[model samples]
Target chain A: MDKVKLGKEQLKELKYFIYSRGFREPEVMMEILDHFACKVEDKLTENPLLSLQDAIKEAHKEFGYNGFYSIKASLDVFTRRRYKRIYWQEVKKILLSPINLLILLLIGLCVYHSMKWAYNNGFYDSYFNRNIVSSLIILIVVCTELIKFIMLPRNNGRSYHISIANTVNYGNFFLFWFFFPSRKLHSVNEILVISIIAVLCSVYYYITTLAHYKMIKAAHKDYDDFKVLVENENPLQ
Target chain B: MEQNQFVKGSLATIILKLLEDNGRMYGYEMTKAVKDITANRMNITEAALYPALHKMVADGVLSATTELVDGRVRKYYSLTKKGKKETANKISALRDALESVQLILTPKIANG
Candidate 1:
């Protein structure tokens, strides 16, 4: 069987046909597009008189009753798993690196000293502590939202890394429950415990922040690579 | 041939073995290679092939890279170090199973 390549116009039409089938992400579309193009080209080669639309329909039919959406659904499952692995790898790096551990300990010590000083300086009232916790929560929520706004739109919502980063950002919500009830410290030991917990949470926050930054950086690289590949394929465009 | 049922359970193993032999392969190319190798006795459908490839990738048994070919991006999958080890294990296991099945189907006659 001879090889037949689809022209630029045919490629564009095929792309629009796939986009119409509800694949919005360019990454997903690219894979599906290549598969569809290969099959349609095969069909056309086998029968030269077959119209491109009919060939496309035949190719689509080959995906069976679930159609191309099955591929997307399966791909999503693997993609989510892959990103979760990446996020855990990031967390492990933060936990395992000696330098990071030292920074975490330093942060813990600073927070502990600051809380102890506050307790001795007559600023340890429950009302004041509650206000501080609330303010911290508010700040974190605002910062998370700001990061999402700044990072997400640029990816065109195509990256699983960005989506996982968004999910990790929302993990900050647990701080409300963890810190809300324990606002007042009854003893120096209590302050110490709270400070330790606070420091750990802050480190977790730092981990996620760093992870989000790396993911967004990776997402940008993915976009850039896609652009370069597309340009190589069609330098004029 | 009705190799679908048999192929379903061993798809990942077959894929691993293929990559072990071929070094790297894209989706359509893998399907074509299987057909050619088996003389069309076995067919790996697109619906099954892509998901299997993606699952191996997620499992860290394979890594994928893309190249622009004929104006479209083609994703080529290659086995990782873990996958190399897995291929050896799977092929050994598959051989043992096939031998067991063959014995069951045509049991050796006992000496009189």
Candidate 2:
């Protein structure tokens, strides 16, 4: 038997039904709608006399007791894991690449030299002077975060995954304030350790910023692709 | 007796095998494929299939893409390179496990 395909209006109704069922996340909704639509189509094929509503109900019944919640939950978990994977992969790639490692070493050297100069100049003897490096780092992070917030993607129907991935956690940077050396530098080892910490922080910020923009760009492309698909299907509607 | 538990244990391997045979498949198609392959004796239910698929995708063992199909956007899952390698290992391991179980089930007879 040939499969009975649903019309656009029927698909819309199915989407609404799923939305009513609380799977509102666009990505999640898309997956659930597709799966639900397939079942409904199967139902229609099995019983051609069935009404769309009845077919929908019958299709929904196949989801069993827990219904779509379990599917949504799983998808949510997958989205988060995928985001984390993308983030860490980029970080690892940047951290491990030979050229990047060389660049990081250069950055560490610059930080060490600057701090050594400040220490030799007796900059750390003053309370305010000791905090200059940490203060500068905190200021740059804050400003970058502010800029990111201001330039957030304007797309309305973005997936929760994108939104969650887009968020920059500032909590990690809070440790910078506490760990920063506040007293006069005692030895070269202290200077070396601080420089390494500074370089690590900078690299962390760099990779996260890179990942943030990458996600936004991908999200925009995804949004455009879906929009085109919808427009193609509803050309004259 | 229905062996949903047995099927559940090997669901990931079963899916990997299916995707290995069929390049790309949607959720409903996978459930149907399992049923057809099992001659309707076993079934892969919705509650079980989606979560497993999503988990595999998360683990980089599978990848999902969406396409417009029959007036709806269908999410199709396929194996990644990692997934392909994993499929081989999983299938071999599962086969070994099944062989061991078969060994246990086949009672030893007195030496004649």
- Binned by DockQ into CAPRI classes (incorrect, acceptable, medium, high), candidate 2 is medium
- What TM-score does chain A reach in every model? 0.81, 0.79
Q: DockQ numbers for every candidate?
A: 0.74, 0.71
Name the candidate that leads on lDDT: 2
List where candidate 1 sits over 4 angstroms from the true fold.
A124-153, A160-162, A171-185, A232-237
Per-residue alpha-carbon lDDT of candidate 1 for residues B51-104, written as tens digits (9 for 90 to 100): 889989988899999898877888999999999999999999999999998989
Interface RMSD of the predictions, in order shown? 1.2, 1.3
TM-scores for the candidates? 0.87, 0.83
List, residue by residue over A82-110, the lDDT tens digit for candidate 1: 56666667778888989988988886676
- Give candidate 2 regions above 4 Å deviation: A122-130, A152-168, A181-200, A215-228, A232-237
CAPRI quality band, candidate 1: medium
Error of 2 at A164 (Å): 3.9
